[model samples]
Target chain A: TQLLEQSPQFLSIQEGENLTVYCNSSSVFSSLQWYRQEPGEGPVLLVTVVTGGEVKKLKRLTFQFGDARKDSSLHITAAQPGDTGLYLCAGPFNFGNEKLTFGTGTRLTIIP
Target chain B: GAGVSQTPSNKVTEKGKYVELRCDPISGHTALYWYRQSLGQGPEFLIYFQGTGAADDSGLPNDRFFAVRPEGSVSTLKIQRTERGDSAVYLCASSLSLAGATQYFGPGTRLTVL
Candidate 1:
């Protein structure tokens, strides 16, 4: 099975601080998706990056897919207390795979 | 329903008992999926259903776990002779179609096996 590993398993920072989380995988994926999950809720999709060297921005959050399609990253600027949640990265190992391989996940806490 | 919905938000059962968890997908969605999430871990794929048939069930840990979707909409996951290790949150998701469609997940059913 394809494995996606996320670094900085746990993170805590003050409000307004900036942080970046990384997801790395040995196997390449056709597309990658980033999700943020709040406590007691299922993960909500934040963005999906489909092309190599692709970058998409959502307000204060920026998502980037590596040129080789084997890695991805999420950068949050001026983080707010509302940003506290678990972040997950998921994708299919191949183009038509129906199941997604999820990363270990990063739990971020933004303190006020 | 507005999105995927799971029944019995929480379940508590003892070992060797039979348990059933239900999931209701969005209207007209052809693809549904089941995943299990242990404490502090990401969700693990369990099964996928395309309409009323199970397209793939490779992720099921063992024979004790079984799922069925009879009407092309509602799906149920059944666990027979459950073990203590079966405790976890069971999540259900649905997508318009397989390939690259976005999946929307339910709040999940937290199962506790004693």
Candidate 2:
């Protein structure tokens, strides 16, 4: 089984602090996706990084993919209370495969 | 367009009971997926449907978990003789294409098997 590991399982920071969540794996994936899930709600897709060494930004959130496609990271700047949620990284275990394997999540809490 | 949606946001049942959870994908989405998320873990894929047929069901943990997507739009996940370990959040997602594309997820059904 392909395994993706995430660091900093839980983070609680005051508003305006910056934090980065890491998702790593030994195996490469065709695509990497990041999702944010709030309590009692389904996960919402935050970004998808497809190419190795790719970088994408969504407002205050920045996402980066490893040069080998085996890892990815999500960096949040000036985090707000609205940004507090569980962040997850997911990708297909195999190329041309339809099933995705998700990494253990990173839960972030931004205190005002 | 509306996003993928699942019914019964929460379900509490005793062990050995049978339960069926429902899902409705986006209006034009052709690919749908089911996943189970345990506490402190990410959502684990259970099945994938392309159109009306299951393209991949290898993620299903056991035979007691069965899912069907009839007519390529609505799907149902049925669990028979549910065990306490089966308690988790059941998530439904739909993509414009397959797993390679961006998938929209539903709020999920929190199944609690006591």
Give candidate 1's chain B TM-score: 0.97
> What TM-score against the true fold does each predicted structure earn?
0.98, 0.97
- DockQ of the candidate models in sequence: 0.85, 0.77
**I-RMSD for candidate 2:** 1.5
TM-score of chain B of 2: 0.97
Q: List the residue pairs that clash in candidate 2.
A: none
lDDT per residue, candidate 2, A9-102, as tens digits? 9999999999999999999999899999998888888888889999999999999999999999999999999998999999986667868799
| Per-residue accuracy of model 2 over B35-113 as CA lDDT, tens digit each | 9999989999999999999989988999999999889999999999999999999999998774477788999999999
- Model 1 segments more than 4 A misplaced: none
- Model-by-model lDDT, in order? 0.94, 0.93
Per-prediction TM-score, chain A only? 0.97, 0.96
